[model samples]
Target: MKSKKIKIMILVIFIVLLFLSIGFYIHKHHQDISTDNAIIDGKTVVLSPKVQGYIKKINVEDNQKISAGDVIMEIDTTDYQVKVDHAQAALLTAKAAISAAQNNAIKAGITAPANVEVSKKKIDAAQATWEKAYADKQRMQMLINSGACSQEQFDQAVATEGSAKATLEQMQAELDASNAAPVIIAASQDTVEQLKAEEKQAKSDLAEAENNLQNTKIIAPMDGRITKRSVEVGSYVEPGTQLCSLVGLDLWITANFKENQLEGMHPGNKVDISVDAFPNLKLTGIVDSFQAGTGSYFSLFPAENATGNFVKTVQRLPVKITFDPLSPEDALLLGPGMSVIPTVHLNKGDV
Candidate 1:
């Protein structure tokens, strides 16, 4: 009975020691980051046309791989081309008007100087003739006083001097009128400004029309695969309408690890990925970072805990993990929403 009691006590002590050792080792050594289930996170872009038109051609098909700047589709550009032509015609008309206005300004600026020169020459000639006529009148008057000249000759000299003075006055009036700026002629500057404004407007219209025409031919902005193609040839699509969604090659994983499993989680830690779609393919990545809060915190309707009824729930934080570059063959099967299980090794010493 004594030996049996001793053996029983020894067995109970051994079991207690085993439990204590397990608890101590768990506290010191083991670390892991795991998620329930995750999908391959990838970038996607929506293709939208700026112009509304009938689809003329669909150059790409679903799942077609395209490069940057490649023309994926085209719309009937007849209307756009017509607009461009109209803009060009309007530009030509504006240019012609500008040329005519410039010529008018030049003519107006030169007319005043020419008239002033002619008036000056006439004034000089009139002065010379008046001087001669006055000398002749003096001679005739002196001859008449000595009874050597006729009265008619004296009167003729006086009339010639009067005529020269009248001519000078008329020329002066004409010169003043010519030198003064006319309202119609001075308005050429305003006309030029108006034409220039019209020309600028026409150029802008032309640019807009050309841009619209170019937009008719829809081009891919990035290298991606076409998906969710909705439009077909001869189908009418309006602006802001959905044409297709492009899935970009860049991909990452969003692992929602439990709060308890994130003790040693850090960025730059190595990770192993196993995708459900391509189980045979092994993907390697590194821990990018952890989001500040749970994914549900950013939901459209977040949980309102202000009410008196409250329940404590464990929140799962999202950890971003970025994958290394893989070849086309290896990455062909990976896509957005594809299931993946990521396991992060949190042992810094082992890394």
Candidate 2:
């Protein structure tokens, strides 16, 4: 009975030890889920021309590191320079015309129309004489009818009144003819306004021409390394044609972790990153943020959930990881597009 009991005890001890070992194994490595699908990412700027022209000079080579404001290339500026000169000439001509028009307008405005003023004075004097002669003729006619004055005197008064009316009418015709004098000033003012508009248009054209001339000199927008140069000397390129791409030196990682493993992985959690390029080189970083949606959702062709053979699949969410500054020894060893693996600590490191 003692031997059987001892054997039963030994079997029970073995089962307990096995369970403890399995529990310890799960406790470690379970919290730190890793993925190899992650990669180093950075900003890439594509270089293009704003104005079309033949490539006259190229100052950079493929994969050359360049700084901001550096002259990248020069387009054949002959056409652009000519355009600028033409625009300048046009602007000068417009300004000169405006000056002449303004002078003419001012002259018209300052000088009152003399013809109208002269005609008005003459008409006034004639009207006064006509009124006087008409009154005298009426008085003489009444006197002759009443036999107070001779018929001859009344007839003389009537002739004098007729002559006065004829003179007044002739002078009135001159006044009517002078009414068109004000129209000259109005026409001059209109010409000035027209010249001003043309001047404005010419100024705008000049500005555009100068802008195109400046665009002929292509300059770097930022400090980056140039890659995939597509232009050579004498190559004709148009606006928006991709000349090359500039990749920034700053780098970060985008790690996509499975949905089930994201329970404890949050932003600010410490992470250990390893690039596949240099297996032994390990880097430290922290989780910055989680992407708003899964990578597949933002892809060119997103999956339709209501398809006939739809089956639920676990989605991996991308997490942006910003790395700590590397020592001088490791600074130049990595770049974008390199495969990386990252492990999240789950626990935010001690404060």
Candidate 3:
């Protein structure tokens, strides 16, 4: 009887311990959500040349850390410099042409109206002389018919009147020609305007040439480390040619959690991160945002559920978790594509 009681007591204790363990595990699962489908991600930029030229010099080595605005490489500037010089010369020539045209316009503005007025005055004087001569011819004719004037005198009067009339007509023609002064002025102004347009085009060309010259020097766009250096001292590269790449210092975590697991998840939820490569390192972050779509929805070949027999499948959504300020050493060590495990404390208050 004693042995049976001992065995029964041991059995009851074992059962109680198992139930307590099960209850603790269930409570912990409700409080936290964890997934191993996460990795460190960051910004990456591929460097390319904007202008084509032979590489004259390279100032960066593979995996070299650099800051923004640092010169990474330089292309041959001989051709580009020549282009700039030619553009400058062309602009100067255009400006000279415009100056000459403007001078012609100014001369026309001053001289053309004066010629018109002079021609008008000459026409008025010639009209008066013709009228006087006509009256003299009429008087001579009357006297000659009455035998008071000589025939030679009458003939001289008639010739004088004819000469005066001819002079008046010539003066009228000169006035008509002078009236075209406005047209001449307009033509000169038009030439000035056309030359001015050419000058504007030349200025634009010069600006473009200067821009291309500046592009010859490749500079870092952000604070990063250079990698995949492919160009040598004399490598010929064209526009859009890959010169190298720069990996940015900014880092984040992308955690893919199952659809059912995201029921209580939200942005600003506290998270504990563990890097696979650094087992001893413990990092903290917060949920920044959720991706707009599931991974499969954005995949190259998404499932056509309507066409095939539909089988219910769990989908995963990517959650962006941004780290709290990391130490300088940790920032330098983390990079893109490193595997990580993240546990989100759903019950914990947000940081």
Candidate 4:
């Protein structure tokens, strides 16, 4: 009878302990939200050429690590260099034309005023000569009428007066032409301005040519690894041709958790991550944000639930988790698309 009682008491204690363990596990599971649908994500850049050319050199191989501003490829510059030279020659020609026009303008400016002054002086001299000749003709006419001068002498004096008057009229016309100096100078200035405009156009062309030439060399945009290389040496490529892709070092995690598990989940919640690739390695991060919509909503073909066969389904929302400072070794091992499992601590006070 004693042996039977001892066995029953031991059974009772074991059952009680089993119940307590179950209750504790349930409480811990509720506090921590975990998801296996997670993967590493990061920025990716597609590299393409802006100008068309044959690939002359390639500085990087597939998966080669690089830094920002590193030259990754070179295009044959024969055609682009020729274009630059042609543009430079055109610019020089334009400058020479501008110089010639400016000199002509300067000459016109000085000659205009001087010509007007000289013409005015010539007109004054011709007028004075005409007046003197008129006086001589009048004196000769008087003398001839009083029979002191001969008719031939009077005729000579009259001809002299007529010649002087004609000279005076010619000088007046010359003065009028000289007064047009301003107009001539203005026309010359206009020519200079036109040449200047041409020079500006030539300068713009030269800049464009230089830019094309510079674009022949492809440079890395950021620190990344070369990936998906598609070009080889001597390969002909045009603008918008995809040469390669660069995968950036910046990374984050995308964890898709069920809607029911998001009750206490929020930004700043602590997370413990485990990468499938390195099973033994562990990582820590924080809940950064929640995606606005479920993953299915952003899919190419979303389901239309309003149709005939309507059935409610639980949705999974993507949560962004950012890593804490990673060690160099960890950084090397971690990469985009790697599978990971993350557990979020809903209580902020919990580690």
**Candidate with the greatest lDDT versus the true structure:** 4
Error of 4 at 35 (Å): 2.7
Q: Which pairs, if any, clash in model 1?
A: none
Residues 93-197, candidate 2, lDDT per residue (tens digit)? 999999999898777765547777888999999999899999999999889889999988999999999999998999999888777657878888899899889
Ranking according to lDDT, highest score first? 4, 3, 2, 1
Query: Candidate 4 residues 41-143, lDDT tens each?
Result: 9989999999999999999999888999999999999999999999999999999999999999999999989999999999999999999999999999899
Q: Candidate 2 — what's its lDDT?
A: 0.87
Better of 1 and 3 by TM-score: 3
Better of 2 and 3 by lDDT: 3
Mark the regions of model 2 whose C-alpha exceeds 4 Å error after superposition.
Answer: 1-30, 121-177, 327-331, 348-351
Candidates' lDDT values, in order?
A: 0.86, 0.87, 0.93, 0.93
lDDT of 3 by residue, 112-160 (tens): 8998999899989999999999999999999999999999999999999
In model 2, residue pairs whose N, Cα or C atoms come closer than 3 Å (at least 3 residues apart or on different chains), thus clashing, are none
Lowest lDDT sum, 10 consecutive residues, model 3, at 342-351
Taking all chains together, each candidate's TM-score versus the true structure is 0.75, 0.75, 0.79, 0.79
TM-score: the better of candidates 2 and 3:
3
Model 2, C-alpha of 256: deviation from truth (Å) = 1.6
* Candidate 3, superposed: residue stretches over 4 Å from native: 1-30, 122-174, 348-351
**What's the number of clashes in each of the models?**
0, 0, 0, 0
